[model samples]
Target: MIKNIIFDFGDVFINLDKPATVNQLSKLDSSFCVSGKMNEINEAYEKGLIATDAFVSFYKSKFPAINEASLINAWNAIILDLPEYRLSFLEQLANEKKYRLFLLSNTNELHIEHVINTCGSDTFNRFKDCFEKFYLSYEIRYRKPDPEIYKYVLSENKLNPEETLFIDDVKENTDAASALRIKTWNLKPGIDDVTMLKDQTCFG
Candidate 1:
């Protein structure tokens, strides 16, 4: 019956330029590579293992050419605006109270800070108020497509896997949820929008 719904934040509700960070970094340091060491640090930062200052410091130390302000700016280049229509849809869905709603996002401190700065805290809270439970990777210290994060959410909320639907823009994330018997829609960003929920077969 889909008693519960889990939604991903980036690309689902908010617009994102996924390649913007890498592109921005490359511009700062001509030899920049999103490889090995940065991947490890990035994953750790997302999981809350590393603090924000330390994160920026790592980049500054590695590149040596980029300062803290520019480095922070480059790192946050991937995040974009939260479309008003999506928020309107989410608010309508939440107000209906037909199903338990949740937000599960793999995000970091710098990006979130930028979002808050751009959107304003009150506006961000308005978006958050739509969800029954809001889970951020950095706050929870767990990120997807890890099985643990999904399991934690299911267990914490006492949600039945069969009655839950998880929507994500990433196939690997959706696949992980499906493995746990949770229904999923691997939504395509430009081709499919979250506001088209009623059109999905899972919604039936």
Candidate 2:
């Protein structure tokens, strides 16, 4: 029986366009592209190795044509929307107390700030309240697909791998969790929805 559930943020609970950032940035300046180094910078930033100001400064220095606001806007273009029905479903799960719930996502400060601004504090807080623990990459200094992060969560919470189920839109992430003996649902963005967890056959 699955007694614990770990969920990914983007494309799972909230709708997202993974390539939205690059597309949006290209509009601001054709030269503003995520080069190899920026990819590394992104990983570092998500892992909390780099501070928010420093991260933004790196972008400003790299792309002097665009102002900070525009850069931030393009960066946040990935976060699309969260459906109210999903929130209602999650709240029902939280209220039932049937399983310990958690949120884990590889995200940075800027994107999160945008999420707060877009969702409004009340809705965001209420959604957050549903989770027993809300873990973000920047705040936790750990991102998914990394063995350490999963181990940290499992060990810290004293959760059994067999009893825990992880849900992520990325197959790579779900594969990593599965390797650790944790059950997983490789959720499909458009075809699968988190709100259908109970109805889904994967849970069994």
> Model 2, 147: alpha-carbon shift in Å?
0.7
Q: Best candidate per lDDT, number?
A: 1
**In candidate 1, residue 28 scores what lDDT?**
83
lDDT of 1 at 18: 95
Q: Write the per-residue lDDT of candidate 1 for residues 117-181, one digit (tens) a residue.
A: 98889889999999999999999999999999999999999999999999999999999999999
lDDT of 2 by residue, 23-131 (tens): 9888888877568999899999999999989998999999899899888888898998888899999999999999999999999998898888888899999999999
TM-score of 1: 0.98
